[model samples]
Structures are given as C-alpha cells and as structure tokens.
Target: MLIHHHKTLCVCDFTTLLELSQPKISRHLAQLREHGIVSDSRKGRWVYYSLNNQLPDWCQRVINETYQASQTELAELLNKSLTSESCCE
Candidate 1:
C-alpha cells in the first residue's frame, strides 16, 4: 500500500515518507505510473502524483487506508524485506 493521501504530493514527499533516496522513490513512482495506480502532471520543475479516480473502489480504498502507518512492528520488518528485495532486483 502506498502512503499517498488525498493531497497531490511531490517526489520529495514520497522519499521522506518512504525513507528512501529521491532516485529510489522516483523509480518506484515510475513503476506505479506504468501500472496507472498514480498519475502525474508537471507544474514547472515539480511533478505531482495522486491516485487515479478511474481505478476500482478497492484500489482507492487501499491507497486511502495505507496512510495509517502499520502498527504490527511487522511494518518495519516488511519495509526492510521490501528494500532488500528491491535492491537485489
């Protein structure tokens, strides 16, 4: 789940929340763009993204609820695992 709230966010915001480098966040955002999960538009030098309204309700729900930082300590664990997996790929 992505932590993207209702606001249209910049890449820097994504990096800060994901605790990842700007380039890393950019790559993931690119992948998400490819899947049509997030749509981007450029305003000057910045790019903003938000969940597409065209998606199924379930997808929007996931993105909406994803912002509530996971509680189980499993979130940090899973984040580590995900980082490792992405780094290796």
Candidate 2:
C-alpha cells in the first residue's frame, strides 16, 4: 500500500493490484485510516485514498523507501489502472 505515496488511489485500484476482495480491502484501509497512515476523499460515488501527509516524518520516509524499493511491482500495478475496467462504477 506504500506504493500509493503522494498519489490517490480508488478502492478498485487496490482490489486490482492486490487481487483481494472488496471487503478485505476496505477492512485493511479502515485500519490504515484509523492509524493515520492513509486518508480518503469522495469523488462522486468513489473514494480515493492517499498517504496522509500529516504523518510523522519517519513514517513518510519509511513509505517512500518502501515505494522506491518496489518500483517494478508498483509500475506493473499502476499500468493496470490505465485500463477501462476497474472495480469502480
């Protein structure tokens, strides 16, 4: 999920990237939101999530490092978002 650093992602994006069920994704996202690691905004019927910039510097640094380390996988996951199909309405 750290791959979402500095970017907004819809639940569909996470579902596609993780190949997980919506309920599972929502559960995890709820946990992240609870911990102040991620935040969400409504765009129509969809909600997009991004890393919470207000997080501690150390937390941001860790997310950045993890994102950097997973660049290849992240790129592949991002490519999926370019498709016309997604879990969103």
Highest-TM-score candidate: 2
Model 1, 46-71: lDDT tens digits are 78787766889987776556555554
**For each candidate, what TM-score against the reference?**
0.63, 0.80
Q: How would you encode candidate 2's per-residue C-alpha lDDT over 1-89 as one tens digit per residue?
A: 43364387787777787688889988989999999988899989999888887999898788778878988877776665535676575
Candidate 1 clashing pairs, residues 3+ apart or interchain: none
Q: What TM-score would you give candidate 1 relative to the actual structure?
A: 0.63
Q: Using lDDT as the measure, which candidate wins?
A: 2
Model 1: CA > 4 A from native: 1-3, 65-89
TM-score of 2: 0.80
